[model samples]
Target chain A: MLKVRLIPVMTFNGVSLVKTKQFTNARTVGNPIQVARVYNSRNVDELVFVDIKATEQGRKINLPLVKKVIDECFMPVTIGGGIRTFEDINDLLGIGADKVLIKSKALQNPEFIVKAVEYFGSQCISIAVDVIVKDREYLIHQKNDEKVLMKTFIEKMHQCNVGEFVVNSVVCDGMMNGFDKILYQNVSQITTKPIVAVGGAGVPSHFTELVQTNYNGALAASSIYHFTQYTPQEVKKNIE
Target chain B: MIVVIDYGMGNLASVQKVIKSLKKEVKITCDKKEIQKASLIVLPGVGSFEQGMKNLNDLGLVDLLYQEVIQNKKPFLGICLGMQLIMEKGSEPNECNGLGWIKGRVVPIVNSRLPVPHLGWNNTYKHKEENQGDTLLNNFYFIHSFHVLPEEAVECTYVDYEFRMVASIEKENIFATQFHPEKSQNAGLLLLKNYIESYA
Candidate 1:
């Protein structure tokens, strides 16, 4: 059986990128190239580059920025930032984006999902779910930063043919309050596709303990780098 | 040199950069002679199957592609829509007919828990003989919605799902990855390079 691996997501908004959260504000961390090199040395399985600025700027995947990412990183790189069209998707994927994440695009024009899969293949596409806890239930968050009921989004994606999903807990996002296993558990029971749980990073055991089912994997940021709590290498060893 | 078949609407440059990352010789070309001359050929595209098929027909490269892969037996690869094109026909509303190199139908990953145009990177199992992980499977990227049900299911190596559909197929001199090896980093580039170097 192929075991679930770790995918460290690095966020970049506007021109500057950040590794850690400074209250509600995100702070600049280091150069993407340098951080990627650190992960590379650790034999990290995959690195995700999400340009937070793209959707708002009405831009596409930053190929030149991607070129900068290509400079120092040598692992399987997944670029997801303001991707809204087949042409944009093609450009990024063509340039060496191992995987492209579709969030708002899928919600807006579900056909865009079909268009992507028809052209790229399902595995090449990933659906990212920004999660939030409300009224004792997990929910789906969108690019407009709105949280919708989970059932609707899941249904929408299922109808369209999404390959995998990343359930990111907005509540647990930066607090390191431990992963919301409940959220993953809820989603996994319903979906057969691979689920990557993002949002919180309380600790390593939190990952092993919180994620009850064998199918889902937890994704964290601050806990791994700035907090100096766990490195991707260490997490990989523990998971194995 | 690996020749990237330019259908004018496919993912060409990305594949080119990926090949370059592995320090391999590659070119994106629409010229038939250049395609014929290359030791390896790649058909990479991103669009509806109907549009892709139409592009091939309009460009008049379909016959040449079939001739190159079938008669000449050069190692040929099709990614995403490229892979679906290998099938007999795509059942989507697109009214597309694939190259028919393999006996199969390209259909929606029906009742897909995931959305259509199944996009993103998922793991792949290898074909029975190819399960040992060749230049292709080390690490690969994937994006697609429709999957081929090869008449020769036994020819399929790895399987993933919008619903238990094939993700990759290997039959003799012809090999195709349903995922994007180029976008898959070292694994993607390595697979492309390995395919290029592996003529036997």
Candidate 2:
């Protein structure tokens, strides 16, 4: 049987690795290279490095740091955060990134997804949809407070030939409670794309629940792996 | 020294990093002389089959590659799109001729509940009869929409993504894996190490 992937997500602010609370109150975590080295020894299925400050700071992801992470880790690396143009994706892939994640860029220009898919194949492209439930409705959040319907955004990306998705919940993001199951199921139903459920993964059972719910993979950040309980191998054992 | 052929396609740095981690002298180049001097050749690629073939042809490496692997019997390994290029022809990104080293046809993976690219980790099961009790069972990362179907190559291992698909193959001096061994953690590294040590 194919194993359910347990991915450890590491967020970066420029060059330093940091953890966020609902996408704010960013706290320094550790060196991204050192953190990735730990995950490398844990036999992790994959690693996601999101540069949280890229788009907001009006600069591209730190390619030098990306190279450092790629050099230290052997498992497949999926880079997210602040990817704007095709050249950025191409440059990253060239330097050993297995996949590139697009968020604000995709929402800003839907055609970017089409062009990216055409240029780099859908397998290498992933979109991270950050969702927040506000006043009895789901809204996609980015740079602005502008509210974009989750279903509509997903539908547009699906049509653009997106291969995988990371449906993250802004409300549940630094809480470590558990994933927003209802939102994930809804997004999964909308498209057949492999969805990586992120945010609010606080325990080992949370991983099992994700596998039971048929989520293609589960991503956790500050919850179980911040030098807490359940290493990646332990979580994989629990999921199995 | 292991020479990783670079033809303007795919991630060659990761391959070089892994090989270096293994404490082996490795080089990434397109120079024909370097390829000739290396003890083994690794063709690692990811992209359209047509484009990959065109790059090799453009670099004028097809004949040198054939001479190294066939004439010299130097161990050769092709990974992902590189593996597909070993076949006689590929159907994706329009039909194009391949290296014709292996007897196979490259075609799109049969549609299933899974997406077309077949991304993520998958269990690799070695053939029971062909098994030599080597460690090939650990999970390996896979991300390809097309697969190679060889006519006469030995199917060392296989995976069932709704259908029985070829995972790895072994011939006289050639070895190829559909999965990205460079990206497949410890098991993948072990496979590469085995190739480097055993296939001479």
What's the lDDT for all of these models? 0.70, 0.84
lDDT of 1 by residue, A64-95 (tens): 87767755555556678788878887777666
Best by TM-score: 2
Clashing pairs in 2: none
The candidate maximizing DockQ is 2
Among all windows of 10 consecutive residues in model 2 chain A, the one with the lowest summed lDDT is: A214-223
Model 2 Cα lDDT, one tens digit per residue, A1-240: 356777899999886888787888888889989989999988888899999888888898888889989888888889987788788998899788988989888988999899898888788899998998888888898667888999999999999998788888999887878778888778878888788888888788877776677666545555568747779888777776
Q: Model 1 over residues B139-183: C-alpha lDDT tens digits? A: 455555567788865466565543366767887777787877765
DockQ of each: 0.19, 0.73
Model 2 CA RMSD to the hidden true structure, in angstroms: 2.2
Per-model TM-score on C-alpha atoms: 0.74, 0.94
